[model samples]
Target: MTGLLAFTVLVALVGLERVAELVVSVRNAAWSKARGGIESGQGHFPFMVVLHTGLLVGALVEAWVRRPDVAPVLAWSMLALVLASQALRWWCIASLGRRWNTRVIVVPGLPPVVSGPYRLVRHPNYVAVVVEGVALPLVHAAWTTALVFTVLNAGLLAVRIRAEDAALETLPRSTEVEHA
Candidate 1:
């Protein structure tokens, strides 16, 4: 019963996060549209959302029913990783500023963002996303969450990377042209 309540709370938290993201996405879409931003890969957006929702549900179900026994040390470690992932995700957002969004939008003539986290990896946001997907559930010893989300997210990332790469392919060649 306690586990079920905890899992329910977690689900609520995840739902809140999704709501926040949806709000952000709406604002981002409006901002980009106002600036005549080009949007590609609209097709994959639904799948991404569904998969993330599934990840949270899967974690909750596994933890509540399976009641996985997680050691304190491992739980703490996973918690730390979750925190670190959030930090990295925010870092990516802050670094990208206006360019950072859930959608793949490219503005013509504007150079790709190449500062901060982008300097290290072309897709730091995705890195944070991947880490969080696995770490969050595993914090409760739900390895099921880690495995399911990692595999699901991997497939999503494959589609995302290809779409983003293709979207950015049309940029005018220059000295600062960065490749992922």
Candidate 2:
């Protein structure tokens, strides 16, 4: 019973985080659009939203139905991962600033961001997302949710990353022209 309540609270917190992200995404989307941003991979965006929403809902439902015993070791490790993923996600958002949007909107003249986590991984935000997809459910012993979301998110990301790369293909050339 106590575990169930705790898991419920965790889901609520994650939902809140999703709300906050949406606020940022909306603001950033507007900023990008005002600057002639061209959106790419529009079709996959809806699936991404559904997948994230399903993660939150599925975690709660799975925990309630399965009521699996939580191993302290697993829980602790997953908690660490969840925290790390959140930090990385926010870092990506801050690094991109007004240029960040939930959609892949490429503003032709803007330079690609190579700072923050992006310095190491081209898609650091997606890395955080993948980590969170697994960690969040495992924290509550929802292995099924974690596995399903990870697999589905993987497919979506394959499409998303390709679109993003195509959108940013000319960034280097544009940057060079500006500096020349």
Candidate 3:
């Protein structure tokens, strides 16, 4: 019905968004590697991939099967959150620019980014991920997917952030650079 169509469109959009992220990640990863980037947290990366893929698949399956009544308030609110999440995600990406990759590969001499959302948060991208994982599902009343993805993503982020921090610890911090 109409709900299914809406859910399908949402999932399609999310899938497209992920494809774009991968495109950017691949390019940036190569850029970083060319500049002597060393990758950490490689072990958990596959799981992270699977988990994210599951977020989309699970959301679609649950929303279709459960057919939960969409409370306009919850749906609209969560929709807004989903939109905000994408904005925050792109902000993190734009902030990092050539330095942003999905993987935690750090270039030794390069400065830690202190621009955009980085000024406020150590891992603003992860914040976007967490919010999107929860809010995207809730947009169509897929509470099960939201809860599961949130918990799993939390564990993943803990490992990811730790590995990233460990890697960063070996490098010297540079003063923030002003961008136009």
Q: Considering every candidate listed, which one attains the maximal lDDT? A: 3
Per-residue lDDT tens digits for candidate 2, residues 22-129, read: 899998888888888889899998899999999999999999999999998987898899889999999998888878778998776788887777778989999999
Q: How many backbone clashes does every candidate have?
A: 0, 0, 0
Report the C-alpha lDDT of model 1 over 20-101, residue by residue, as the tens digit. 7667767776776677779999899999988988878888878888887777787678777877877887787767666667
| Model 2, position 12: C-alpha lDDT score | 91
| Model 1 residue 174 CA deviation in Å | 6.5
Rank all candidate structures by their TM-score, best first, as comma-separated numbers: 3, 2, 1
Q: Please provide TM-scores, in order, for all candidate models, with all chains considered together.
A: 0.87, 0.93, 0.96
lDDT of each: 0.78, 0.87, 0.90
Error of 2 at 59 (Å): 0.6
For model 1, give the 10-residue run with minimal summed lDDT.
Answer: 171-180
Clashes of 1: 0
TM-score of 3: 0.96
